[model samples]
Target: MLDWLIIGGGIHGTHAALRLTAQAGVAADRVRLLDPQPSLLARWTQCTGNVQMPFLRSPVVHHIGLSAFELFEFSRTPEGKRFAAFAPPYDRPAYALFQAHCHHLLTQHRLPELHIQSKAVGLHRMGERGWRVETPAGGLDARRVVLALGLSDQPAYPAWTAALASSGAPVRHVFDPNFRAAELGDWQQAVVFGGGISAAQLALALAARQPGTVTLLLPHPLRIHQFDSDPGWLGPKYMRAFEAERSLDRRRRMIREARHRGSVPKDVAQNLRLAAQRRELRLCEAQVLDAQPTDAHRIQLHLSPGDSLETDCLLLATGFDGRRPGGAWLDAAVATYELPIAPCGYPVVSRALRWARGLYVMGPLAELELGPTARNIAGARKAADRLAQVAERRRTGHQVTAA
Candidate 1:
């Protein structure tokens, strides 16, 4: 049996595995990261590349490495200084620089050897032994399991997209794993939906490629916020009050309110405005009420305020679904194991992100405990810190492990 089996080899899972081996003294051979992708952070790379995002919204310090300042220190290295590493305001690292730093860490620690390219379909307790995770290849036994699943698998499509697709219109979500921006085909006009950073970046990219041929349709005026949530949520400034709250419903509300949903950063917003002024991109502020295929190659989108648009391609940068991830397999596990969930159907995990005995959660699952930043890179670091403490206590012969 493995010492730790992490399901999902994205940012959260990679960070968890690194923390276990590097800080908790767990043998790298004993820890495994299970993901459907062939490599770690593949989905992250794909999604960011699809949008042509230049820099990350997160700061340079928020990375998957063992130390908080590792990325910052890397900036001073010869390789890191090759390109534009950090942006202004908050020193947000360029996407290329961030990925390079992550690659360095993964290679230095040999974390890729711990990866198992398989999807975890089922999970069940093994009584006193530990837990068994069911995959297509077979079942793997582990003393502990961390569900580090991300929201990438659950892309949120607008309601009108289904009908438009059925009518033979070209509509795609930017975050779809199979949706390649390079294969978007030659189109006279393209409509990029959503008002968030991804939509803005994608619109800018499309406009730059084909000036005066791209339109950004925003449901509302573009909201400008540097980060998704206030930086206070990362530390005890906002987290202290959040942790003191005993009500999960209230906590959910707090998270929703704290998140700056469908918003862009100041830099991105500024760039978008400049593109609009240059006539390279057209910005429209109105909700898409419905859409219909005007012909085989054209779609007429009915917008709010009695306006309509005809376009050859429609790209949705709409984010992921708000539903709990892991689908029916996880629902079955939750029912069979009787794991405690909040009223919103999210995991009610402990401070260490433990949901059940020997079972932990990260990403969206740990939101209630980690606060609004639970789905970001900083949350992964926070989770690693908590899990490291647990692993250290376990190493020292502590037995209080029940959640």
Candidate 2:
């Protein structure tokens, strides 16, 4: 049995492992990170690479390292200086810099040695001992379990997407596992659906690849926000008030209000404006009412309030569906373990993100407690702090012994 088994080896899981072994004094050998990806952050790499994102919307303090200034400190180094591209106040690291920093951390810690490249399909409590996780390859028994699943796997598709998909035209969700931007061939016209940063990036990418070939279909005019949410949520100001809410339903409502729904960062908005000026990208305010396949191997999107647009390709950058996380695996675990779920289909977890004794949650699953930032990299940092405290306390009490 291992001391800790962390599911989903993306940002949250990877960061938690780092906190446990490096900061919290948990031995690396005693912890195992389970993810289906062959390597850590593979999905993250793919999703970001697919859109050709430039700089991170997040700040320098938000990273995978144990210290808050770790990334900032690295930025001062000669090699690291090449990665620095900030816009003041918020030291928005370039995507390459952020990725390199993550890789440096992984290499320094030998994190790959602690990874188990398998999908956790099932999880069950082992009574007084611990928990047992079932994967296609084998089973893992751990004294403690942390479900650090972030939102990489859950892609949001509207009801009308099914019709478009069955129509067999060139329609694909940006986060679809099988779809790759590089795989696409010559296309005269392209349409990207959604109003968020993903759509902006995709629109720009397609336009740059083939100028005047991309149309950004938006349900509403794009909104601008420097960060995903206000920074007050990161500290006690907003959190104190949020925690004081006492009602889970109200907390959920607060989260919905706090989030910058369907918005892009300032830089993205500026770039998009430039693209529109150059006539390389077309931005339209319209809702997709329906989609039909054309004989020319294309899609015709019917819009609301009356209009239509035809395109050779369609990319849904509509973001992830927050209502469902973990999918079948979560449903199975909830059924078997009798875990409590909120009305939104998210797990009902404790302040420490505990689903049960020795079983915990992080990332979006902890949204009720972590608030709107729960799905972002900053949320991973907050989750790490909470879980690390719990893990440390549990270790000191011998409530969970290392195997």
Candidate 3:
């Protein structure tokens, strides 16, 4: 049996594994990262590439490394100094630089050897022994398990997209793992549906390629925010009050209010403005009421303000669904183990991020306990810190359980 098995090899899972091995003194060989992708952060790379995002929204300090200063210190190195490494305002690392730093960490620690390229299909407790995670290859036993699933798997598609897809129109969600933006063949008209940074970046990319033929469809005027949420959420500033709130419903409301949904950064907004001024992109602020396929291999979107638009390609950067991830497999596990979930269906983890006796959570599952930043890189780091403490206690012969 493995000492720790983390399901999902994205940012959260990779961070958790690194923390357990490097900081918590857990044997590297005893922990495993279970994921469907062939490599760690594959989905992140794919999604970011799909949008052609130049830099991350999060600051340079928020990464899957041991120290907050690691990435900054790396920037001083010859290798890290090559690219246009850091952006202004918050020193957000360029995507390429961030990827290179991640590669360095993974190689230095040999974390890739811990990867198991298989999707976890089911999870069940095995009594005193621990837990058993079901995968297509077989079941793997672990003393502890961490569910580090992210929201990317649950791509949000607007209701109107269904009809357009049924009519054989070219409609794709930018975050879809298989959706390759470069593979999109020659198209005279393209429409991107969303208002967030992803939509803005994708619109800018398409506009550069097709110019004047790309339109960004938004439900509201563009709003600019440097980060998705206030930086206060990262530390005790906002978190102290959030942790004191006992009501889960109110906490959920606070999280929703704190997130700057469907907004972009100032730089991205500026680029969009430049694109519009140059006639490279069109911005339309209206709700999509319905959609249909036109006879000429196009899609016609009916707008709420008595307007209509037609395009050869309709791309959705609408973000991910708000539903609890892990799907039926997780639902089954929840039912079987009677894990405590909030009214919103997310796990009610402890301060240490333990969902149960031996099961821990990260990313979306730890949101209620970790606050609004629970799905970002900062949250992953925080969750890993807490979990590392738990591992240390276990190693020192202290029995720890879900609070």
Cα-based lDDT for every prediction: 0.91, 0.86, 0.91
- Which consecutive 10 residues in model 1 have the weakest lDDT in total? 394-403
Could you give candidate 1's per-residue lDDT for residues 1-403 as a string of tens digits?
Answer: 9989999999999999999999998988899999999899899888888999889999878989888788888878887777546898878988888988888889999999999999988999999788999999999999999999899989999888888767767888999988989777878999999989999999999998999999999998989999999999989899999999999999999999999999999899999999999999999999888899988889999999899999988999999998999999899999998999999999998877899889999999999999999999999999888888888888888764544
Per-model TM-score versus the true fold:
0.98, 0.95, 0.97
Which tens-of-lDDT digit does each residue in 5-112 have in candidate 3? 999999999999999999999999899999999899889888888999888999888989899989988888987888647788889999888988999899999999
Instruction: Report the Cα lDDT for candidate 1.
Output: 0.91
RMSD, each candidate, Å? 1.2, 2.4, 1.3
Query: How well is each residue in 1-403 modelled by candidate 2, as lDDT tens digits?
Result: 8999999898999999999998887989999999988899888888888888878889888999989999988888786788867654487888888988899899999999999999988888899899999999878999899988877677889898887776677888889877787788888789999999989998998999999988999989889988879999988989999988877888889999999988998888999999999999999998888988885479889998899999988899988877657768778879887888877777777777888777888888889889989889999999999878877876687553221
Q: Candidate 1 — which residues are off by over 4 angstroms?
A: 399-403
Q: 216, model 3: CA deviation in Å?
A: 1.0
Deviation (Å) of 220 in candidate 1: 0.5
**Higher-scoring candidate on TM-score, 2 or 3:** 3
**Candidates ranked, most accurate by TM-score first:** 1, 3, 2
Off by over 4 Å in 2: 398-403
